[model samples]
Every structure is written in structure tokens, then in C-alpha cells.
Target: MHDDRFQLPADADERTLLTCFLDWHRKALVRTCAGLPDEQLRRRAVPTSNLTLLGLVRHLAGVERWYFQGGIAENYPGSLYTATGKLGEDFDDLDSATGEASFAIWRAEVETSRRITAERPLEALSTHVITGQSLSLRWVLNHMIDEYARHNGHADLIREAIDGQVGE
Candidate 1:
């Protein structure tokens, strides 16, 4: 409910608005994980779900890599958390994964994503390796906004479950 500095502005252009929203969503997830102990941060806070703050952090890090480096840049630097032929590895092993490492990777990936996008125009296209489909930076930004928005909602519930603290 409290308005933070990360909130997207209503008057911005398409590019500015999209980037701000994505950033707001990113910070929302991080805010949810802030101040919690490593154990609680990594706990499966949702019922019948493998979702955890730490895992979300790792998952987002991989997402950053997949979208920016793998998808946009087409660099294929490899996944951050999941190994080859593995699935959901980011959201797995919550008990042993530490928040510090996860945050470090997540933050770094975000920085890289920002750089990649800043250097390109919204109409710039990138190919998807699996589907051989071309996608524009516009599409990537929209997708990232939606992706982080959904995940941040889950993070909100989990954080509320862990502690009484709650906000956008």
C-alpha cells in the first residue's frame, strides 16, 4: 500500500513506462525478501508449491540470463542455476540454497539485462534458439513486466505468510 520510489510513472512514454514497471516489479520481489533470515527466506512458504524467495531470486536470475543474454543478445552464456537437462532447478533445493548467493546472481543479472536493453532500441529483434522465432525488445520488456508482476504477487503472499510485513 505504501508507494515506493520504484513505482512506475503514469506520464512516461512507452519505453520508460515499460522499464519502470519491470524495475518496480523486480524491486517488489527483493523488498519482500529483505531482512528475512536465510532459512525463512528459502522456505517453501506457499502450500503445495516450491516457491520461495531465495528460489525466486535464483529463478529470476536465470530468467535475466535467458531473456537478455540467451534470447536478446543470443550469447548463450548458459543457465545460472539449472544444469543441462534439468528443470526447475532454480526453484529446487531450497533448504541448502543461500539467499546471499542468490541475491548476488540476481542483482548481477538485472544489471546485465539493463545494459543489454539500454544499448538497443525497442524494435531491435532477437531470435529464440529453440523456436527460431524473432522477438523484439518491446516484446521482451512487456514479457518481463508480466513475468515479474506475477512472481512478485506470489512473493507478496509468501512474505506475508512468513512475517506480518506486507506492501506493493
Candidate 2:
């Protein structure tokens, strides 16, 4: 497999390090779903959790939009997945989800996020979606890293259970 997460430099600045780690985790989610069919991608391996690789992709796309566009960029074009007021629709509507479309949406959102934050200072603040409070870019980056890491852990288990494929 072609891994993009291993290209991190040993001596890098804080933003570089954080963004590299975020990119690594981003690709980790993609890496975990590689070669799997759409049906397999939508499989909820864990009986207790409704999370699927496809769902994660859709969820993350919405999250990327929520934080970057809605929160940080203040674009507020509404959520990509939860626009119907159906919370958790990303995971709930997996039977009709297509892996290719989900991945494309996610990739586009990630690109948009990068563009939005690239020139912004870490201390620059944006209003929160729910709280109407100021949120710094630093907090957003940290939260995104944490979100991806947490979901990627679930993805690891799901992928392994799907075909026994495993790695960081």
C-alpha cells in the first residue's frame, strides 16, 4: 500500500507537526478502508457501534464543514450530512451511502479546511456554532486531531474485523 503518513520531518515547527499529524490521521482513515467494497465499507462490524468506514467518511466531511466552514471560516452553509435535521444521519443512512462519493466529499472538505487555515494565525478566533463563543484556531486544530484519532481507533477495529488487516 502507498502510505503518506510516514513522511513527517524530525525537526518541524508546531503548525507543521500538528498539521502533519492531522494529515496522518486523515490518511489513516482512508488507508483503513482501502480495497474494501462499498458494502464492506458500510459494514458495522461492532455490534455495539453503528460506525462504518463509509459513515466515518461522511461524518468527518460534515465535521470538517462544521468546524472549518461553520466554526472557523464562519461560512455556515449548513451541514453536509445533517442538513435534514436528522442528527447522526451519516451513520444511520449507510445502506444508501456510496463510498466513492463519501470519500470525494471528505477530500474536498479537507482541502477547504487546509485553505481556510493555511494563512490564519493559531490564536485567531472564530465563533462557535452552538455556543456563540470565540474559538481559536489552535483549539480547532487540537479538536480535529483528537476527533480523527478517536474515530481512527474505531476504524482500526472495524477494518481488522472485516479482513484482519491491521497496522498504524
Candidate 3:
């Protein structure tokens, strides 16, 4: 009920608005998981789904690295998870997942992403790791906002199922 996300400004530059909205959504995802037990955080509340709050964190950690570090910075080492040719490992492998470590990795990756964004202008371009096509920082930022917005919705539902907690 007490939100700690960045308050979006009524008037701001494009970069500020994009980054602020992205950060707000990023915090919203973490807020969805706050104060929950590790086991509860890993619960697949949805029937026939592997989606979990911890998995979403893990997935977003990799996503941050993939988009900002890899796509924009062009220095992708590899996935934070899914290295064993096991796709969806981030969401499926939660047998031993811990909230502390997962959140830490997610935060670290997000910090790196902020740094990457700070170094470039909106018009700055980089190649997409998959499509091998050029993209601007602005595009990447918008994509990240979309990515987090979609996943945050999932997190909210999963959290609600876990403990009946719900909010923006």
C-alpha cells in the first residue's frame, strides 16, 4: 500500500520520462514480491504455469543484461541463467532458488543497465543481438518499459494468489 517507486514528473525530457517510468515499473516488480517468504515467492500459483515471482526476477535480471548490456552496449557475455541449453530455466528451475541471491543479481544487473543508459544519448545506436539490426537507446528503453510492465502484471497476480496481497 506504500509505494516507494520514483514519482513521474508532469513535465520532463524524453530520457527522464522513459527512465523514470522504467524505474518505477522495476521497483513495482520488486514491491510485488516484498515481505514474502522464499518458498512462497517460488510458488507457481497459476495452474499449468511455471510463472513465479522469483522466476520473474531471475528472468528480468537476464533481460536487463541482454537488452542494455548486450543489445545496447554490445558486450553481452551470455545469459545470467539458461546456460545449459535449458530454455525457461529461469522460470522452471526454482527448486533451490533463494530470494536474497535472485534479488541481488537483479539489482546488480539493473544498476549496470542504468550506467549503460547514462552513457548514451537517446539517438545512440547499437545492434540487436538476435536480429542483427540497428536500434537506438530510445527503442531499447521503450522495449524495457514494455517488458517490465507485462511481467509486473504477472507478478501481481502470482503474489495475489500466494497471499491475497494486491496493489499498483
Best by lDDT: 3
Quote the lDDT for 78 in model 3.
86
**Stretches of candidate 2 above 4 Å error?**
1-11, 84-87
TM-score of 2: 0.90
* Residue lDDT tens for model 2, 1-168: 654545666677778877888888898898888999999999989888888888889999988888888888877777787757766787887777888989999999999999988969888899966658788888989999999999998888889999998635
Candidate 3 segments exceeding 4 Å error: 1-9, 84-86, 129-131
Which tens-of-lDDT digit does each residue in 1-168 have in candidate 3? Answer: 554333555667899888888998998997889899899988998779989999999999999998998899988878888968687888977889899999999999999999999999999999977658788999999999999999999998998898899646
Number of the top candidate by TM-score?
3
* Per-model lDDT: 0.83, 0.86, 0.89
Candidate 1, position 10, lDDT: 61
Ranking by TM-score: 3, 2, 1
Clashing pairs in 2: none
CA deviation > 4 Å runs, candidate 1: 1-11
The predictions' CA RMSDs to the true structure, in order, are: 2.2, 2.1, 1.9
TM-score, every prediction: 0.90, 0.90, 0.92
